[model samples]
Each structure stands twice: as C-alpha cells, then as structure tokens.
Target: DQQVKQNSPSLSVQEGRISILNCDYTNSMFDYFLWYKKYPAEGPTFLISISSIKDKNEDGRFTVFLNKSAKHLSLHIVPSQPGDSAVYFCAARPVGADGLTFGKGTHLIIQP
Candidate 1:
C-alpha cells in the first residue's frame, strides 16, 4: 500500500491567489516530509520540507504544515503564478531511512 497519498488529482487557481494542496500518510514513523515540484518530462525538484518536530515551515511564497496526530500535511502557495504551474508531489521519509515514499502528485494550474 502507498504510504503517502494526494487525494486531489488537480487544482486550478487564479493568478495572485492562494493554492492549497493536501497530503496524508499512513506511517507514524515518518519523521521528515518534503514537497517537490515537477514539470512534464522532467524530474521533481525539492521545494520545501518540515521535520516532525515542527508543525509548520515557511519559505518565500510557500509554507508547509504538519499535523502529526492527524497523520496529515498540507502545502500553501501564496500569490500563485503561472510559473508555479506544475505537478506537486508529497514525500515522506523515516527517521533515518535513506529512501522516500511519494504520493502520486497533484497538478496545479495557475490561470491568468
């Protein structure tokens, strides 16, 4: 079974608005969570991440929140731009594991 899941297959938002992406995981041992963005025919690039010890993490125009108790996580993108349009993937890693478990991905489209 997949450890990480992105329930939404795609989302559309107007430029300069906010885009919210959600993810859920089945493992409690996952201590690190990451969000990666990928363009078609390319590899995923690491966006932002949060440790289990942190409930929230923020970067310029991006933020990630974790709810350990609920076994869920979410990503927020502010002032969405057309350049931000891509497939976003949610990934999780064990406390000291070398590999990551990834969700299918959610396609985000920024409308003009």
Candidate 2:
C-alpha cells in the first residue's frame, strides 16, 4: 500500500507568491519527513525536513510543517521564483527504519 501521497499532481504559483505543497500519509509509524526538489535531469536535492516531534521547520524561503494527528504535512515556499519550478517529493521515514517512503511528487510550476 502507498504510505505517502500527494493528492495534487501539480501546482502553479505566480512568482513572488507563496506556494504550498501538501502531502498525507497512512502510516502512523512515520517519525520523520523530508522534502526534496528535483530538476529535469538532476538528482533530487534536499529542501527541508521536519521531525514528528515538531510541528514546523524552516530554512530560508522554505518551510515544512507536520501534523501528526492528521497524518499530513506540507511544504511552503514564499516569494516563489522562476528557479523554484520543479518536481517536489514528500518523503517519510518510519520509526527505526533506515529507508524512506516517497510520494509520487507534485510538479510545481512557477509562473513569472
């Protein structure tokens, strides 16, 4: 069964606006969340991460929020730029698991 899911297949945001990407999980064992951004031909690079113990985490223009009760998480990018256009994957790791489960990913298009 798919543990992680990004309900929206794609999202479009105007430049300099806030872009919100959402994700949900069915596994209660998940204890960590990671957001990765991938370009057309490049490997997915880490964007930001948050632990289940916390509700939010931020890094520069990127922020990740986790809601254990709802089994949902989201990534927010403020002041979206042209270079922010890419595919974003939501990944989660279960307690004590060394590997991570990834969602299908959402294509974020930054319109300028």
lDDT tens per residue, model 1, 1-112: 9899999999999999999999999999999999999999999999999999999999999999999999999999998999999999999999879999999999999999
Compared with the true structure, the alpha-carbon lDDT of candidate 1 equals 0.98
TM per candidate comes to 0.98, 0.98
Q: Please report, as a residue range, the 10-residue window in candidate 2 with the lowest summed lDDT.
A: 44-53
Looking at model 1, residue 46 earns an lDDT score of 98
Candidate 2 at 97: error in angstroms?
A: 0.8
Which number leads on lDDT?
1
Name model 2 segments beyond 4 Å from true: none
The residue-level lDDT of candidate 2 at 102 comes to: 100
Over the stretch 1-112, how does candidate 2's per-residue lDDT look in tens digits?
A: 8899999999999999999999999999999999999999999999999999999999999999999999999999998999999999999999999998999999999999
Computed on alpha carbons, the lDDT of every model, listed in order, comes to: 0.98, 0.96
In model 2, state the lDDT of residue 42.
95
- Distance from true location, Cα of 52 in model 1, Å: 0.1
Residue 77 error, candidate 2, Å: 0.2
